[model samples]
Target: MRRALHAAPEILANFVAPYGVYEMLAAHWGDTDALIASAVPPLLWSFYELAKTRRVDAISVVVVSAILLTVGATFMGGSARLIQMRDAMVTGVVGVMFLATLGMKKPMIFYLARATVARGTADGAAEYELVWERPGVPQVFRVLTLVWGLGLVVQTSCMCWLAWIWPIGRFLLLSPFISFGIFGLLMFWSLGYIARRPAARAILAR
Candidate 1:
């Protein structure tokens, strides 16, 4: 319960923030510029919070900043459909980044997982470093990263399709759930797959 409470703010920020802005903008203000202006403040607040938090990983800062920039551009010039489509681009960019890093010594997922699981604590950081060095460990993360990358791209494609064909209100209501659902499944599968791997199990047991 305590852990859940601790996570609530981030969870809300990630899942609810944009949707809330969109809803509010759609409700009171019909003008595009007004919608755009209203959207900026919440994102700025998010950026500020990300910068202020000592425990935040670098990736979080980068991701939030990317979101702010994308939102700004989308609102400044994009049509309603374009705004929706551009929003999906953020996830798409992450997918591209993941695939782009696959040829490197460390896959994108390695850094993401490290930032998530090993942030702030020295002991956790040491364990993550050792995990990446273990034989076959990188292979596991590489495969998982590939899955995640492809999954995100697939999600983006779906969002694009819906944005083009579906009502904006309906798309806004459903897209977040769809994104979370796909990611939850992928995360479950990746964790299960890793747990079954001998090398991954050994490292995780540490």
Candidate 2:
């Protein structure tokens, strides 16, 4: 087990080393189109869950969100300005997602965090609605929503900045440290918080 664990880093390094970024994500997740299909369910589940306790609202996101995004990027492709700041493209898409959910006063992050709530079975969509109506949940979700959206914006901006100033390979070197540091802090904070609650800690500790 120790030997296998030690080799895990090499396995990951080797996987990405030979492939382009798009290719790597595709292969890792089984295929590129699979990524989109995989992404939609969680958001949809969130809506379905929230809609029960809250009023019935429109869908938060759908095909147009993805297509129009690509279209917008395509229009600016030749502009060179878009190409350089093109990293912001995904950020814009995510911001739009938050906006779409904002109309319903639903924050997208809590959908992901629902598992942290007691008895949040991912398969049980109705339970998400139940969770949403719990005390202080919606407020926590909105803060989570803002944090998620703002964090993505800042992260994307940093990526663009790195790509602009650094050479191609350097961004890879720098990004991991920055990401690790941020996640490390969050993880440490969460560890303390979760440790205090046995039920919530079970979910988080997982």
Q: Could you say which candidate leads in TM-score?
A: 1
Question: In model 2, which regions exceed 4 Å deviation?
Answer: 1-85, 88-92, 114-123, 183-206
Question: How many backbone clashes does every candidate have?
Answer: 0, 0
lDDT of 2 by residue, 1-206 (tens): 99999766544443333234434455555433322322333334444445554422122233335444544553443423334256235654675576466557566655545434423344444555665665655665565556556665666677678656764334434554654565575457555654664444323322
For each candidate, give its TM-score against the true structure.
Answer: 0.79, 0.51
Our tally of clashes for model 2 stands at 0
85-177: candidate 1 lDDT, tens digit per residue: 777777888888788889998887777777766655667756787787788887898898799889889988998898889876677657778
Global lDDT of model 1: 0.73
Alpha-carbon deviation at 127 in model 2, angstroms: 2.1
> What does candidate 2 score on TM?
0.51
lDDT for residue 166 in candidate 1, whole number 0-100: 83
Which window of 10 residues has the lowest lDDT sum in candidate 2? 55-64
